[model samples]
Target: MAACIVEPILSSGGVIDPPAGYFAALKRKCEERGMLLIVDEAQTGLCRTGSWYAFERDGIVPDILTLSKTLGAGLPLAAVITTAEIEQAAHDRGYLFFTTHVSDPLVAAVGVTVLDVLQRDGLDTRAAQAGSALRAGLLELQERHECVGDVRGRGLMQGIELVTDRATKQGADRLGSAVTARCFELGLHMNVVQLPGMGGIFRIAPPLTASDEEIRTGLDILDTAIAECVSAAV
Candidate 1:
């Protein structure tokens, strides 16, 4: 097998965070099969998960690492990192990799600046602190709302699954759409998972630079939207 590529936290997959030591166990399985373990940190890297990378919490280093999204800070740039032995092997095999717009100095500079700011401003720690407040707010909402079936995630990346009935855990797909539309109308754009069987999952990822007041304001907007939508349903 070439490699097993995975997103440390399933962002579009309902923002699911794997259980503790999950990656460690997966890595062991990969080793047994003589396959390379590749971690894709496009959405969870650069302090998005309260750390430089979500895989750090797993305590296992991947054989290959891929990064993008936050790395360019909106620009189109990506990176692949691997150990010297693997890199040498690939080079010896004459393997070539390049994107349509490769070697752009402007984007490269932006990526460097992003790294500098993430480190200089201690955004990793900021993400952790902000995530704590965000999760607390989400939990409070879960307690107050019967439709909030589940709240799960880590750091600034979180998700809340809406259900018609919490006891059944059935996805409230239509209600999810309504709440998102209401949130947009209220000037707070919300993202809901579009996949079948996961349509009720709402992905809530606030910017790491957001202030405490901003986070609270967003939560308030979300609360108002959910309440309005649920009331309209009845």
Candidate 2:
């Protein structure tokens, strides 16, 4: 029997650090059970979380690392990084896979340009700093708006959780959807998430190239939408 474990750092509409002893425990368990640990950094990789890979922040390396999302910078690309041992194991079984249109030169060029821009413009550092500022501002907004229950995330990836009851922390799905629609109407694209076992959380992940002024403008529009929704609900 083979097993795989997928652990992501998402909680309370925020990206909480993984459990204090999660990595150590996972290493021990995986070694004992002979299971593979796969880290999926599709959404959290490519300096989106202030690090080349989010797992780097946890100080643990996975047997298999999957990446996509921003890697191609709007082009279709995905990658799986693994150790030589794993590669040998797969090759020993004579498993060689090839795909059609694996790497279009045009897309590859775009990826190269994206990497250049990210390094030249210091987007990783900018994402960290700008994300911190955005989180702080959202926290202040939460204090001002009863509808805002929590603000959480890191780097360019953040979420604003809307709640109808502060005591119970119940999600206000309609309110969140309304706010997203309002922001879109106000010319700012935003996401309203609907995940199982989670409440209404607004997903805010702007392009890494977005300027500080663009972030502020988007947030201002969001503030207006949130306020308007709260007022209309009363």
Best by lDDT: 1
Residue 56, model 2, lDDT:
72
Candidate 2, RMSD to the unseen true structure: 2.4
Best prediction by TM-score: 1
Evaluate model 1: give its lDDT.
0.93
For residues 1-234, write the lDDT of model 1, one tens digit per residue. 877999989999898888999999999999999999999998898999899989999899999998998889888889888999999999999999887778789998999999999999999999999999999999999999999999999999999999999888999999999999999999898989989888799999898899999999999999999999999999
Question: Could you give the C-alpha RMSD of every candidate to the true structure, in order shown?
Answer: 0.9, 2.4
Which segments of model 2 are wrong by more than 4 Å? 1-7, 10-17, 196-199
For model 2, where is the 10-residue window of minimal lDDT?
7-16
Give TM per candidate.
0.97, 0.89
In candidate 2, clashing pairs total: 0
Candidates in order have lDDT scores of: 0.93, 0.78
lDDT of 2 by residue, 1-234 (tens): 354656445523344456546765776688799988887777877778777776776577889888777878887987778999998998998988788867678877887787788888888898888888788778888988988888877788888888998889998888887888888899988776657645378777788877888888988898899899889888
